[model samples]
Target: MRAGGFLIPVLLVLAGCKPEPEAPALALHPVPVQQRLPAQVSAPALESGRVSIRGDDALADVLSWTLPEASIEQPARARAAARRALAKGDLFETAESAIPLLLALRKAQPDNAQDARLLEKARAALLAQAWIALDAGEDLASLRYAQRHGTVLRTLWPALPEAKTYLDAVDRAGQAFELCVGGERALHAGNLDTSGGALELFRRAQALWPLQTRAQRGIAAVQAALLAGAQAQAAEGDFEGAYAELSRAGRVRSDAEAIATARQRIEATRTDRIRRLGDEGLMALADPAGLQIARERLAEILRIALPGSGAGVALRQRIDLVGHYGLFRPGQVFTDEMADGGRGPALSVLPRGGFSMGAPEDEEGASPDEQPQHPVRFERGFAMTRHEITVGQFRRFVTATGATPRATQRGHSLAYDARSGNFLRGSGIDWQSGYDGRPAGEDMPVIHVTARDAEAYAAWLSEQTGVHYRLPSEAEFEYALRAGGQTLYPWGVGAPPAGAGNLAGGKDVSTRGRSWSNAFPGYGDGWWGPAPVGRFAANAYGLYDMVGNVSEWVADCWHRGYRRAPSNGQAWVNPGCRTRMYRGSSWASAPAQARSAWRASGGVDATNARVGFRLVRQL
Candidate 1:
């Protein structure tokens, strides 16, 4: 007994020192395997749907110490997580999280009828949220949710037939939205096939939902855009543009208003094509000779049909003005009237003859070609303008012959100053101002005539006077100035003597006068503008202003070189009259231009304030 007592004490001490069996680890790192009710009625489905959680246990077990009512807070935490996913457009995550809480609710209260209804509502809400995600351009999230939840819903749908119908409708709406979204994406990427396919599906959805306002508008807008594109292609000459347009038009609903509008638009397009064809036909036949006729016809058509179309109207007017007045034609001419009506005893025999033409090589104003002097012989004679016809003379011609002046005359004329190249509205001279810059007189030369107008006046004179009145051939003009002599000028082989002619007032200054004294050069008078045509000594032929005053018109087409020029005194009429020749010089021009051999050409239709003319005829 004494030994047993000792052993018992030693055993007790040994047991106490043997780490106390670790006291079950003092429950410090203890984990209780307490039964965990599901977090909600649908926790199992949520877990199956792959919703990852921290631990595979009741949520209450993990957080029971933190909350007095851990079971109640469990549903709230699950809902919060689901809400977070939904807000991020994560449809799959939202549905997965929500399902667990639903399962937990069902598990914790299987006998409650309301639990089943709650689960159904939760499932429906998840589906609707998935549709929302699809609408938000989240295609991957939408597909994930639809694949997982759709199977469940479809299976659950049969039991709740009404819910099945709702889910089906939601699915259809989502599909329509997806097709439209896909079409826009493809269009952005320039993939025609994908975009067209999606657009067609979008149209089908519109048909399926006949009462949906947004769907109808969407379909209408696409149809209109498609038609516009096809029309643009048609304008670019694509024949298939018509078929594309028709296809787009066919997509419109068969309502009377829409059908009628489409038909009207189609008819309008055909009309535009007809008009364009006519214009192209005209342009195809465009040429210089027939330009006038073509322009008149086009103007008449537009005036009668397209009066309000701005471009068409402008083109129509432009064609008429440019073509009719811009070119010359055969049998056109001009003439002078005072010579026929007044003092020289009606010397209507306007003789034309060629002479040794060109200025002398030693002359101050001579050009090189004017040096290799040549002779030109006129086989015929033309009647010429007697004393340069005055402005009053032309007014009388206009009144007696009922001829229309080429340019419109008005009381208010354009006031132009070449010094500044500026214009303003001022009325210093009347339209009838004579070439001499004096008031209207019977003997002064006419002024303010375009070359075309002068030609027309000459033609009118020819008809009225019963003689062929026209401009002198260039050879005849120079011959008359020299009077059959090849001298430097009509007077002698030197510059003009004082009082011999009107020119710049100094020897060096050939364009303007410098001092107030009249002893500058030829004219000796400080006349800044034209004097009367007879104010200076006449040439050997008794013609006036061969070198100054106003230049004369000659009947040769302007050409740059005489390489292939005709040797006879006749007009050059080839190439359809691109330019008209002007001989002699104007008051505003330098004396160099006044040289007998100097020749220049200008547009036949252009008129200048400084330009005027004398006419000639065949005798």
Candidate 2:
């Protein structure tokens, strides 16, 4: 307990609660005692002494207890009687006890070694008892017992050296206990750093008693408090306050391992939180209506993220692109609703990155036009139709706008002929016709459309959806076809994997029971003609049929090689060029034509059953 812990109510006794009406107003203590003034701060006492109500009653209590005097008695009788009392365990606090009786006998026979031995033995017993009481605990009763008896021993046995040494040891233990008590109170009140405050008191106690458990635990508690405060501040978005608390904790520990562990824990916790928020925001971009939530998540990231946080940067970019086409993540599939309740083709958001635009020169099955492999990168991401445009989707464009498709105007389009085992021009074949020039199913990919017819369809759909829609650039087409890989085929090297797409296969038996002479040895996709769009497994970017089914037209004009190709992945157009480039393998394409880098071109007005097109929306 510190000094002045309790206030002894005094002064203005007449104002006190009624005790006696006629008698003079009385004090609570019945006499004067030193008291602190109102509102005064209590000073921490190193050792708070026992308080007394300085009055006649207190004085009389102390005055009443007197020290026993050694009585004179015959030496022989005293020795016999003292021995009997010692054997009965009666040592002190009575005249009949052993110590006073020995003292009486020692005065009479100072030269007697037997009497001297008895006196010394009684003193040692008292000292040992005192040590047992003190060792029990630092509670008030134990402490008071130790201190009160120490004073008695030194006063009564003034000539004994051991008494003084034992007393000194007891005093040091008492001091250490008192210091920690004061420190604990100060810690609870948050007075940790003030002069003579908790930290100082704890250190002082440790110095006094090197192995004191109280002091050791107190220091650890202080450090824990500091670290907890730092975490709370960071949670509240107060980085300055959080760092300040961490710095304070560092001072308390200051060891390299401790500091590094503390910092790593804080950063790991924060990084995990930032990463979760970034992932949630990125997911929100997969839904166009979730753009608002994505923006909100990004705002939170900016507020709490550390400088140069990668999660924060990623979230910000995703938020920026969310408003474009209702925000889809890379490889995420989505679609837009047109004005007349018709939805555009399902599209997959393409990842923005660099890739080798054409096949490497030394690759197997490499073509002369695919030589000089060059780099191409898209600065901004774009969304590509997840599958080729289906016949049902194109029919909507034709039904809405009264436009004559090129194949319909020419009255002929090239189509597969089972008897000839080749594509041959036939009348009555148009965008509505199947590979065999029969009426195509709605789900089958639209074929036999010229490049201009495909472009016109994209333009009509753009007006319907209020967004930019066009054919993908040749570089974009190749990069997306590879889909984050550099491989000989879209699905990787060697023979095509099973069900890779509707590609030419050695096992395939056509309607005329004929298979290609040169085809993938063991691959079969279970299809003889163009299957429904997205019938096969999607590529890495969630796009389907980029290497098979039917080859598709791109925005780039025909080029001999990539020597003069655009590096930014934009369509390289030569004005008024009639020849246009188309890419990917057809269902009847040979193994060499199935290469990932394969390219071919035809007159813009040309139409064929083996060719189709898909569109991309600029983001």
Candidate 3:
């Protein structure tokens, strides 16, 4: 009993741990046996007059049972039935089976004139059917019928006038049918032009047979093709072309749903195009050149009227604002002769803004003095001369002020010697004489003038014109030189582009006696000494000779580096400041020295052939 008790406890534990047994699998029932019945054969006879044409067996039975008896005994009655069938346009029965029966009648009754007349009627009926088929554009079927009719008519009556005339008509109709077929093919091929294309061919077909269905179908196909083409053009952003195509399609099928949908799509595309143009115009407001392009784009949009169009009004307001703010207008200039009866320098209005004062650190060959690039802002706009002060302009100043320039008082000036290939102080050379010791041209930039002399000229100009004329500050000089760019040079990061400005290009080597050894490599500007003012292309601000030809005097005192430069673009002047600052490289300077950020310090009284200046009038 104790052993049994232990076994029971172990069985209980095992039962708890084990999984339950799966349910019994489904059982399949046995298939029932089918019994076969004895076969029985019974044939049903076809009706006496009815026949089945469903298969060869049925057709053969009918032909054997019915054709022979009727064809032999009642040949005349067979001919009459075939004639009646032909008259009813039942050509399949009349031509395929009845024709043979009618031939048998003619042979059996060789002297019967009715048999010949019935054969002629059959041929005439076929000719009529051929004409009908030609009108329907069934060229293959029509041609087959025409040839069969011709063969039968020729065999029976070799010179039948009616047959010949019918055949001639069939030939003419065949031509028209072929043209209609070609029109349909061209329409399927997507040639839907109104003139000299598929549509014209369709119209010609209609003109030949006014009630032809093939021509009508060809016209409908062309209309559908035009609508489809319009939809494709609209998808490709050609709204005007799409609209024109849709209008043509409307003329063809005014009630077509696709035509209406295509017109709606064209309208939507045009509206979207106008909106895009307006957005582009608004985006261009920040740049002068882009703004002009924007104006053109917006004008185009206005040319095509849109519902609720505000693009033109908005663009006009933006343009007006730009004009009111005295923004730089390309090619706009102000010119007036000075009091001394000499033509004054042309001046271009400059916009007031902030710009970086020096070159960036990564710029190639950048100097340390141009470090700490900082922003300098101008509070008001100004107008600066488009070209440097010319010799004639300085002469007028001298004639009015009765002033003696430093170079003139010195009795000699530094001049380039072409024969010796070197620069030397030449006797009897002064401001009136050029850098080559020749009489200066009236249009050439005046040279060998001290900063004080330039200041005196500005003072005389301000007094004569009753305007605030002065030398541009160092910040203003660099700002105007840069124009609107941040490159190492005014143009861009590469070596100065050809004809940008007159630097120490090799153009002077043969004419001026000497060429800069470290000049911009491989550059030749075509001028040795300073070129006539405005010879080179102007900068973005419409100022010429800002970087080369001559270093220009500014109103700043020399402070080495821009350690604490003025942020407001004012001149950094101090009391008794002996050393004044000049910006830009001279004709004798290397390419790197001609950069917009390059700075040179000279005594206020210093004069040389490489130094000159331009003036500005505050507005």
Candidate 4:
């Protein structure tokens, strides 16, 4: 039967005429058509015929066959299909195929009301899909879908509320998402300055997306960072900086407990700092040199705005006291009597004032070393003994401390020899021995003591009285000697008045058969060697034996002249200095040598009957 079917087609082709066109072939099941066809029917010819037939009528047949029961010819069925696609979240297919088809059906079938309703339903489904994209956080996709189909839907159904509503929702979602992203970025960067702006963004985000958690957490993180930064600033002692950070945090979330705690810590730290500064100022009151530092600290405390508090008031008062009266005022004299032996010197206060140290060049007997006289000032006042340290006081020091005088250790000292009329080193003479080789009286000024011995005695005195006792500076010694007088002698410009001081005179010739080669000639108090302490009348400043009796050791390294002397009455000490300056003159000194500005320098370790020292108490 298959052979007869092929032969009929061949016989028809064998006729010299074209055969009539038959219906296009289609299969409901797979068939071996290639094998069943005539050999003359080439594969290309078969394929061409199949394509032609599909173009003619198989297209509709294939679509009807592939589509599930719905046909484009039926508008209601097509609209239903689009709805199903939208429901399944197939936005692309709904926009590209279903929406266009529904629009065409609505245009063609205007009178059919059901077709118009189905068309409207399909457009609504597209609008819903756009909103769905928005809900899924696909901002670009949502915007794209809306832009693609929104215009058509709006034009077709002017009263469809969801068209406008969905678009508005998309805009709000976009803004909220943008704000949330910005806030999170700022929080992650730890930018406190920009954190406030970021928080504003988060707040706006919450306004848009009321149920969003990211915006809320972003705001909390920013506030926490600000509070933590404030705490760190407080720990570093920057209260103002901390307050600024805290204020920003407060703006973000005003009711946070951490903010309140940080504020409290800042207040407590400020108070403690003020208190510490007050204590430091009080401690500084003990020393005049520390007044500057105290003032600085107190000024800082005052700037912190501690109102009407006792601590602030006390600090101000203390600062004022220091400013007005200084740590120690001038003209305030006191005495320190030792508790153990009741053997300490009377002290007189000298204020911070200016003076011209050394004598004028034109002054009589003024040496070149005393030339170029310069001005000096004292910033801090000190208390000085009224008289030179006496043999009795030195003896007490030696007995208490067991300190041996340099001369005593050497077993001899510089003594004035009556036979030779010259100062000669004598055996068995020490501080206990007078310049004449006789035992010194208890009240006599200590002689034959080196500078080291004087320093040791001053040290012991300081330990005994719990005061700072030391030798006077050269300028200090001169200032005390002048006692506000401008004369050659503390008594006057001329030779010392009778009984004014124990100077070289007729008394020396009569007692020791030796006298100054050029003596005052008319002046003679009494003693030829060393006189008792305070035997001479006190100077204008109540200091005794300032110009005579014996030269006093001063705390200054010997300089060639007043070339580089201190403008202040402070000691010019040189480390390992071998020579020390001694002011005033000895009992055997000539009248010119006894002048106030007649200075002499000697070996620091040299022991002589002429050298002695007085003590000063630093206040």
Highest lDDT against the true fold, candidate: 2
User: Which 10-residue span in candidate 1 carries the lowest summed lDDT?
Assistant: 20-29
lDDT score of residue 170 within candidate 4 = 43
Every model's TM-score: 0.41, 0.48, 0.46, 0.48
Native-to-model Cα distance after best TM-score fit, residue 538 in candidate 1, in Å: 3.1
Superposed model 3: Cα runs more than 4 Å off: 1-331, 336-343, 506-508, 512-514
Error of model 2, residue 198, in angstroms: 99
Q: Encode model 1's per-residue lDDT on 350-447: one tens digit a residue.
A: 23355655654566767664545566665434344434556665776677677655434433333334344333333444336543223545555565
Tell me the alpha-carbon RMSD of every candidate.
Answer: 26.3, 26.1, 33.4, 33.7
Whichever of 2 and 4 has more lDDT, that candidate is 2
Poorly placed runs, candidate 2 (over 4 Å): 1-326
As a TM-score, model 4 comes out at: 0.48
- Per-candidate Cα lDDT values, in order, are 0.47, 0.72, 0.66, 0.66
lDDT of 2 by residue, 1-619 (tens): 1122111211121122111111111111112222121245321332334222121232232223334575765678778877887877566667777788888887788899998898787777778766666565344445555655565575577445566555554555556666666766666565554588777877876765554566766665555566666666665556667678778767764556755766676676576556545544554454455578778887877777777655567567656655564355677777888999978889889987899878787888788798699888765577999889889989988888988899999899999898988889999999999999999999999998988888889878877886657788788789888999898888888988777999989888887888889889988887788989888888889899998999999987888988888776777777458999999999989999988899999999999988999998755
Q: What TM-score, to 2 decimals, does candidate 1 have?
A: 0.41
Residue 296 miss distance in model 2 (angstroms): 34
**lDDT, residue 95, model 1:** 34
- State the lDDT of candidate 3 residue by residue for 1-619, as single tens digits: 0121122322232232221122111111111111111134221221122111121232222122222223547765677777777667654333334455556677788888887787667666666664555444344444344434444444444456655544444433333355565565455445566456667876765654454555666666666666666766765556667778778877864567867776786677666566545434543443444568668877777776455756366555655564454544444688655665655568988777889998778877787788778898765566788888989989988987799998888788788887886788888887788878899998888888888889789878865764446788888899899998887788887777788888887545654355667888778887777888988889888899998888888878898678798776767877447899999888788878878788989998776678789987654
Q: Candidate 3's error at 599, in angstroms? A: 0.7
